[model samples]
Target: MKRAHFIYLLLLWCIPMMGIAQIVPENPSSGALQSVQNLQVSDVPNDAGDEINISWDFPDDLDKSQITEIRIYRSTSASGPFRQIDAFPLVLDSYTDADDDETGHIVTPKDTYYYKIGLFNGSEEVTSQVSEGVSPQISFFNWGRLNVFIILGIYFALILYFIRASRKGREIYIRTLPGLEALEESVGRATEMGKPVLYMPGIDEANNIQTLYSMVILRYVTQLVAEYETPLIVTVGKAFVVPLAEETVRQGYMDAGRPDLYNQDIVRYYSDEQFAAAAGVSGVILREKPATNIYLGSFYAESLILAETGFLTGSIQIAGTGNIHQLPFFVVACDYTLIGEEFYAASAYLSEDPKLLGPLKAADWMKILAVGFIGVGAVLETFGIDLFPRLLQI
Candidate 1:
């Protein structure tokens, strides 16, 4: 099976528990704090057993102005030798202690420990009773990100289902990309004019996502040009991309059953410098005047320079990139453009391979799910109901 890498989702952070305090064990500390009730210690949940959570209550009659700071103390035994772990202002009533404390104190998973709280004035201090035994327990899965994991599971299932269906000859419908549709027209025009086609796979490193997608599209284009026996030129910017582009071009020729037409020098190397590569490639656009010009991959400032130069040469141009900012320039200059994820979907669209098609279809389903979630969340928010938000807090 030809496996394609599934892209990741951007998840937001966990909800903060700033104003929440826990049940009391008893507070004996005082400066002007009469009864600092409910000093409790527990394990920090949904973590790798690396932290302990301590919380205390802010009493109704507490005089905040008279207190200088609140302090936390930790020890292995309840008998003696307790050391100060943290001190913070009167505003906060909770702290999360990590195993990597700067005091060289270490707490292992399932190790019993005791904690104490202290109140301090300008010159005097008072201490609280030690908390009961608390230990950090390692959790394999984070309950905070439970919703994200659930969504991911459903997405994977959809992918697997589609893959099996596709393999069994079930047809999947993916919307057509105009940029891709124009490739045939571009090649046909080049063949008619007896002029070569020029392809630039962006200026960034080959490992970049945009560059990687560009390579896939490049392979498809190479095969098209090979089938028509039209000359193809692949120009690259980064030094590392030279060999990859060469291999892809070679593979494309062989896949089209025209390996004899493959030329090693067809994939040319420019410079690693951004503008320098743009200038060198622009010179080729002017000199060769290729009938079709295709630019795909990660691009920066040089995007407009190359596209504009190709436009001036009156070539049938098609451009695609993941960079949104550069899309405006490509849209203005090129006859057709692949916008954002359209470039990513090219591999599945061109090949129709079951492995790639499954993921592409799964992503579409995920987007539909996302839109539904957003719509429901908005409706609930209008009614002052926070069911969806609270579900994420778990």
Candidate 2:
């Protein structure tokens, strides 16, 4: 028993010594076998100043095959329990250590940090001397974004020019949109048939640009319906759009000298749920069988459902949306469809207000300018003159 106990104690002591031999070099001079030299530390420029870049030179005489791993460590102090920041293949000589955690959450900012590179062979590691301290800083201007600023400035200038010219009473001419022209006919047919006209302001809140444009067209449509003495039904998918739609309809009636004929029930707010709103609107179409169905604004998969239901009701359907995918459905189901930007241009066409017309004219001119650029680019590309492409690069 004594002999067995003595052997067991000897084995435990030998195991720890073996581990120490593998992890730590017996001769300190062996660490010179692989070395990192001329270490550099600098803050990254044109950034929020939360990153430090570290670079060094690997010993040329060292055997590259023997180097299995390289690690980067950072510390706030020279005498440090250096935290391992990253590990990479032996080939890498540089690293960027952002003053953040692994998940990109900021841990330290404006804090001076020191870094060291480690070369590993199996369980053994040789560490280089510490680098000079670095602190991250923010720059006032990032020249990288200068090109974006220039483009935005040009666009805004163009819009302002048109707006000012319009205010000065310069008449801006816009060709009549087919969709706007058909509005009168739709209202007239509804009036003759003595059936109500149904208008859906899309399935979006008032904040949406598409919904705002829809309101602009709604005002005009309401006026036409009031003038024709036809009952109008406005169903909206958002509660926020309800009051806006109601007021627009009321104003239209007032403008047409038919305020007394207006009813609060004419404008209804449906559920915000997409399919639910679609179903509710579809039920309205089937039940009331409106002579005219006008759909304008943002739409999604439910677009086909609403348009198809209106088609089955034999209504003169006029649909418009910015969602391109749903355009095919509307084009097929509706008698007339305002495709993409045509829907936006319809409001300005019908209203002819200088406020709207000026912007419309400016947009058209901008589009012409864009086409010119494309043509120039194509010609240059054909001739192998790459200068134009480089000029466009930021």
Candidate 3:
């Protein structure tokens, strides 16, 4: 009788605890942050490495006092019973997976990792839905060769079309603009001034698309200068650009059949410091007093200082910069200013090089497509309709 009573009492005592464990409060509010959103991932570059970066928007109510830590969970399957692999103190809302490897949490390339991020409030844990899997894939197409082929095809097509159009006696009318007229006069002024022509390629590394555009423009400018027998002074900021610029100027001289007139001293590399570079170029402007000054490439605050100095020297300045903030100064000072896309379009416009021009035309088509999408979206939104973004994805 005594043993039966004791067992019964023990069972009675444990039942409530078990019940409590099973019962999770519905819509329980915690002092800690509540939500996470906007997760994204991309492959790490320059290696045979498979990695994904994750970032998220934290809850508005998030505070240090409420949350103690964030627990990160990962799973191979999207619909997963995810396993917790890492935990971070709730000091920062963002965390990178790269730091988790030291803790023996190993991720292999063969397996795709989907992540679930959760916040550990003092009493309750709130978790977000698992993010989409990041999987790596390789392409069979040789992109390098394909790119070259595409460029050549476009070039040949444009040349043939232009030739045929000319033979048919079609008026090939192109719109006239002030900037276009200035190019010829700028070169002419340089020839008559008995001073060197100065070209400052904007201070940016080679990887920048703007710098590449600047180089293309330089080719045409150098050719014109070489033909005129005008001394051209080219100052570049990057070490990498120095060799490429030298080759481009050399080719331009060769094309003009005045290779003997081409001088190495004309193309010089200046310091990379923003202010220091501007100061050095200014000194060259002051001493050489070039009749025409061409400033092209990406520029920052130094744009005004350079333009002002060039203006004071009475050089017929033609400036082009994709930097929108610096455009105002260039517009006020430069005799010819190529705005935004015009600066990018300058090389193709001058050379009529189809390899470059084809891409520019394609980009314009893309803009039209984008504008059409925006118009449709606006119409839907005005009618209180939501155009689901997901359905558009392949």
- Give me the overall lDDT of model 2: 0.86
Q: Which residue runs of candidate 1 sit more than 4 Å off their true CA positions?
A: 1-37, 58-72, 85-91, 99-107, 117-128, 191-196, 202-209, 229-243, 258-290, 299-302, 323-326, 354-361, 392-394
What is candidate 1's TM-score against the reference?
Answer: 0.73
* Model 2 residue 260 lDDT score: 92
Give the alpha carbon lDDT tens digit for every residue of 184-215 in model 1: 99999999999999999999997798887788
Relative to the true structure, candidate 3 reaches a TM of 0.65
Question: Candidate 2, residues 245-271: lDDT per residue as tens digits?
Answer: 989889888988889989989998889
Which 10-residue span in candidate 1 carries the lowest summed lDDT? 6-15
- Candidate 2 wrongly placed segments (more than 4 Å): 1-81, 84-104, 107-109, 113-134, 139-142, 254-262, 382-394
Clashes of 3: 0
lDDT of 3: 0.77
Clashing pairs in 1: 24-38
What lDDT does model 1 reach? 0.86
